[model samples]
Target: MAVSQSSVFSESARGDAALSQINITPLIDVMLVLLIIFMVISPVVGLNLDARLPQANREATAPTVPPLQLVAQADGRYRLDGVVHGLDTLRSALVQSAANDPERVLMVSASADADYQAFANALATAEASGIRQIAHGQ
Candidate 1:
């Protein structure tokens, strides 16, 4: 009887080749089971509470005093509430208005062809007259 060592070694090497490669069937099954468990429990984990938000009042309150409108014209004159006023007159009026309510807003507007100097003078006058809130308009 002749014993071949090469044949025995070859059979063992083939068995090791199969063992070296990883089998992923059990890993895939475990992942799918975890995914299903998370999907079923996700909805129940959220809080379900009834909340009551405060509603706004439907009543409309009117303003006590109307806003002052000032317009700078191209002729170097200012218009206060549609009345044209000279530089000195505009200053006096602004001072009187500020005396009434210093917190009131003065809306200053200029025409497309209005003088830039006039607009600047109007803003300066308002500031000098103690009018704190000044708004620009088209």
Candidate 2:
């Protein structure tokens, strides 16, 4: 009779081969637990304090003086208080008005067909004449 030897290790059990796939089961479990905790605690953590905000006065005071109207025409002229004036005359008039009342507001309106240069010139003249407050009108 002859005695035979058998090996217990298999060829697939070799340690030289590295793991190619990653296991995400633990990561998914942790993420689900965190999501559940947040959902359960979010309502308890919210603030429900009652706040009293200060109310503003709704009454509006009327202006002491009416605003001066300046309209820019398409023909490169300006209408100040319904009187047409050239650029030089407009500058002089604006300067006079500004001297009279420095707080007076000038409301500028441009005609639909008015040149952009005319509008810009009107603004520039108003600023040069020491007018502080200027407003735009439709």
Candidate 3:
């Protein structure tokens, strides 16, 4: 039996050329798996709170007493009923007002460009000064 060197060399070259071609089937399979995983997990990540809708009631009554207005300025100053006050005297002023009219509602009217901390401070002062009801005004 005689084996030709040319034939052996040709077979080796064919095998090497086959290896040079890229195999994309595995890469496509991995990409499809990642896409499916993201599609399944995306909705669950945003599912946070489950809220109950309130039933409509037509017989609700309105409040009788007028609300006290407290305005928050852009410069961190507060105005309660046309009197401007700073943070140092805010709590005392709220307490005095509450003493006069215990049933009056405390309304905070924050400026359009006021900082969030200013509004929060006004709310805290009202609550800490023994005011029962508090609300935000336009």
Best by TM-score: 1
> Would you estimate the TM-scores of all the predictions?
0.58, 0.56, 0.53
- Of the pair 1 and 2, which is ahead by TM-score? 1
- Residue pairs with backbone overlap in model 2: none
Deviation (Å) of 68 in candidate 1: 0.7
Q: What tens-digit string does per-residue lDDT give for candidate 2 at 1-85?
A: 5533332243334432435457799999999999999999999889687899988766775567989999999999999999999
lDDT of 2 at 60: 70
Q: Which stretches of candidate 1 lie over 4 Å from their true place?
A: 1-45, 48-64
Native-vs-model 3 lDDT?
0.91
Best by lDDT: 3
Kindly give the number of clashing pairs for every candidate. 0, 0, 0
Across 31-133, the per-residue lDDT of candidate 3 in tens digits comes to 9999999999999998988898997775786557778889988999999988999987889999998898887899998999999999999999999999998
Go through the candidates in order and give each one's C-alpha lDDT.
Answer: 0.89, 0.90, 0.91
Residue 33 of model 2, lDDT score: 100
Q: Please list the residue runs of candidate 2 whose C-alpha ends up more than 4 Å from where it truly belongs after superposition.
A: 1-63
Considering summed lDDT, which 10 consecutive residues are worst modelled in model 1? 57-66
